[model samples]
Target chain A: MNITSDMIYGYTDGMILCCLSEQDSYGYAINNFILEKSGFKYELKEATLYTTFRRLEKQGHVTSYWGNESSGPRRRYYSITQEGRAYLKQRIREWKEIRQLMDAFFIDKKEEETET
Target chain B: MNMEEKIILYINRAFAGSPAAEKTEEAKEALCADLLEKYRGLIEKGHSPEAAYQATISGIGDIFELVDSVTGENREKALPSSSKILPAAESFQKWGPAAVCGIFFLLWLIRFYLAPGLLFASGLPTFLLGAVLGALGMRAFLHRNRLSFAPLLPKEQRPYQLVWGGCGLLFLAALFSRRLNPALWLIPAGAVALHQVISAWIAFSASRKEEDFHE
Candidate 1:
């Protein structure tokens, strides 16, 4: 609830891709990973999740294949692409840079507090 | 359709009837297997079947938004060099082969009638064969691994099946005209057009749906 929606949407695809890079996964598995990792703090709607899958696939960040299940229809399993790995690396750098920038600005408040 | 069923329907709509045999089935099987497993787990955890399915679906997300963002959706684009300027290049992208074949077909009709047996050794059916083979070859080209424009084309190319397929049937009818009367050929032609037009309309309508991916 405290997190800005923008921040969540922006990073979701990258997070999903990074998760998929570890191994191929389907939509639900990916969602669960996000939930478990965030300690149930962050969850994406199914619509948002598939859109990220589509976006990543479109961007050459991931590829999906179908596998037969014991019951019901086949599942579409997605995996990270080489380009996706490179993209995740870039996003990681950008996220770190943003974190450091925010930390610097927020900590600067302490310096000004003493001066005042 | 129920939530789970709806998901299956969409996946089939996307990957079924692809140019290659294995490609569509492969896509369908993978999506179905994982989605169903997830659905099963939710049901086991004390959720109503429908609610569980809904929750699972709500978590998966919108495909068009994904496709649009994936390929970077653009404003209406016209097929190049056409003063007639048919709207919807994205739409045309699907039927590209048919439209191309249509032009060639019309040309061939003229040639076959005006210059009957011009390529006397191979005959008209040979040209038709060439068209079918050409379409097949192009399908092979389009679906080839390390596909030239993989990311852009995969999601976008699916809608074209009806178009290419229509042209193919038309070409086949024309090829086998001697075996079957010219009148019988129109059945397939009408069927082809009906299918492509309807499919094109559906795909185009879906294209207009809200991408719904915030930020």
Candidate 2:
């Protein structure tokens, strides 16, 4: 089944933080990387991506500076702050716990039922 | 229009009345660059120009939410002329003196026409004028105190105080000159009516501009 946007909405902030954790990147680069990494299976709207960037910046989890792109318009690049790293660490731990709980409730139970 | 022009026009329409603050301008410039890159990539991938344009436009999603994030919740400072009802405290700050003056003027009129002897003995008209001036002075003092502590008023809105101050002066002049003829009172009354009309015209034009931008 294809994943719906609703399924990924809650993780957008974490996903963005992960992107910034790798290197300082502009809007187009981050979105393109996500698209390539997902095999073009997922794409986010420009509006949503920018909104998240503003929110994260406001929360002190990210900082931005304009890139010296000589051609066309200058790009605003975002880098994760130390607080962003701490937050991402917490989110990853929580995500792992939830994944483990889901496996216990679904995969293990399904295997047991099949064996019986 | 070219693809770049089309995208810029669309963005301008979306953010018409938003402030051109430095941070906001940076975000907008960044979005424009990204969208242009995406459009170029689509064209390189053999999409028809029309299809590419449509794709780029659709990729923006609901832009109002994005603008809101840039403006934040404290939009009053960013958009002073935005159609927003004043908070109760601010409303009182603006209208309280006018209300007090209005009541006193009404009382003076009733007494002058219906109880002439008592009106003369008590000098009710003079008393009303004094009360109006006193209320206005107190308001000014309070406003000055507030300014020392906080930047409460927007620059664009300060002209309203001048409008009211001129009306108050006209009222006192009319009251003092009423001995020439009872009709002298109409001068101040006419000034009040003129002030209301001017205020309404300003509000109407502002709202029309807001609508034009949104459209």
Best by DockQ: 2
Model 2 off-target regions past 4 Å? A108-116, B73-142, B145-215
Write one digit per residue (lDDT tens) for candidate 1, span B48-143: 988887776665556445334322322112113342345697447645765676666666666666877675445656666556655665564454
Model 2 Cα shift for residue A90 (angstroms): 1.0
Off by over 4 Å in 1: A1-5, A68-71, A107-116, B1-35, B60-215
> On a 0 to 100 scale, what is the lDDT of residue B9 in model 2?
72
DockQ of each: 0.35, 0.69
Candidates in order have lDDT scores of: 0.65, 0.77
Q: Which candidate is the best by TM-score?
A: 2
Tens digit per residue, CA lDDT, model 2, B1-215: 57677887788778766756765677678888998888899999999888998999898888888888876744645444313587888767666766666666677667665776664554546566656665665565455334332234545555665666776766656565646457666656766787788789888998898667556
**Residue-level lDDT for B1 in candidate 1:** 44
> What are the per-model C-alpha RMSD values against the true structure?
13.1, 8.1
Tell me chain A's TM-score in each of the predictions: 0.87, 0.89
lDDT of 1 by residue, A1-116 (tens): 54544668689988898788789988778878988888888876655776667668767889876666566666688888899999999999999999899989988998899999
